[model samples]
Target: MLQVISLVLENKPGALMRVTGVLSQRGYNIESLTVARTLDPEVSRMTIVVDVDATLRQQVVKQMNKLINVLQASDLTESPAVVRELVLVRVRTAQESRTAVLKEAEIFGGRVVDSSTEGFAIEVTGAPEKLNEFIDVMGSYGEIDVTRSGALAIALDARKLKLQPPVPTKAGVKMEETAI
Candidate 1:
């Protein structure tokens, strides 16, 4: 029942606050949120994950689109998209467990970002499920301190969300083919 809702909003003061406020006021719990400036400095993209059923999912998107600074909002949960999260883990490593931890990290495509006699700091990025599995495996090694960057997602279909407008020519004419 988790939905991935993506929004393109004007990068203006209170833009983020307004969007979040709407959700909070409605009493919807946001599972995760990731926001960053898009290629256009004037715009920002936000990826929000909320655990809502189908009926509430539609309501969330509808409310988002009604926000003043919001350009577009789409639920990407059922769409073709690439989603990922980054996790940094510091795991207690003893001489006996160091090799096992390193090997597990290697298998999960995690990099040893930092290492000391007591522990190893590993950086891993992948689908949320994959990261969950890696974290579970790492937990067996010893105590772990974890930091996660919540889900960030983008639709694969061009029509799902468009943050950029058509390009303008020197003559001040918008190019049709350049629309994205």
Candidate 2:
């Protein structure tokens, strides 16, 4: 099964290499990896998709957490999350078939980002399956070039990696539970 592992890491040099090194050393295949700066400039968020069973998932999460730069790591495979990918396809379009390609692009909520005498570059963003369908349909037009952004996801609930101190209770005790 495919699992999405979201990790929060300190924005420091060699952090990314450390994380990827761990996976590589373990011989785990990464299907997709997307990393970007978060709202906090001192932190970065990494969304990695890997094919692993339940036992391996736990082991991977554990190994990720052991990395000094990794602040938090969680497997969101079973969580309610919004996952998406982006694909830009340049399709050869003739005057005769341009309309058909444009119509199909619209059907998939894609936009013609660029157009030229040779082809039209359409940008599409959605679930992976939707992008696959769009690519399969556009293949008939003859693909000139294609670029894709791997899957990125976030949980629907409020659970997030944070550094705030624990909330205090009425009895002056700190709550051990997480915000989620």
Candidate 3:
């Protein structure tokens, strides 16, 4: 199973390295990771995706918390969340296949984010399975290149989950659905 672990660490050198090193030392392969600053300048948040069995994952989470730099770590796979991944794809399309490509893109909720004489660059965001289906369907059209962003997850709750010094949320972003 893939566990998406979120971390909040101080903005300093070697902090991220320590966390990654702990996982690497344990031979856990990271499938994806996304790190960014919250509203605060002193802290940064990270979402890490790794595939590990439940029992060992608990151990890993314990070890992660032990790290001085790690403020929070959780197995979001156990939470009710909506997961999304962004894909930027460039496809080789001829004049004859242009319409077909556009149609497929629309069917997949993708848009032509970029275009050139060579081809088009499509942008799509969806669940992992849906993204896989979109990528698979694009293969028949022509040569394709793709890049994906790591998964980010937010838990839904009345209480603010702290991975570091807590950050506040404004109005409108609710707790009903946690986006992963």
**What TM value does model 3 have?**
0.84
lDDT of 2 by residue, 1-180 (tens): 798988899999999999888788878788999999999999999999888777877888998999878999888899889889999999996778888999999999999999988879999999988999999999987755778899998888787566646676755433433332
Which candidate leads in lDDT? 1
Q: The CA-based lDDT of model 3 is what?
A: 0.82
TM-score of each: 0.86, 0.86, 0.84
Model 1, span 1-180: residue lDDT tens: 788999999999999888888678878788899999999999899999887767777887898899879999998999999999999999997799999999999999999999999989999999999999999999999999999999999899985544456676765444554563
lDDT at 74 for candidate 2? Answer: 85
State residue 113's C-alpha deviation in candidate 2, in Å.
0.7
lDDT (Cα, 0-100) at 102 in candidate 1: 93
**Against the unseen true structure, what C-alpha lDDT does each candidate score?**
0.90, 0.87, 0.82
* Per-candidate RMSD, Å: 7.3, 8.0, 11.7
Residue-level lDDT of model 3, residues 34-114, one tens digit each, is 888888887888888898777898888888888887777766778766567889989997889998999999999998989
2 against 3, candidate with superior lDDT? 2
- lDDT at 12 for candidate 2? 98
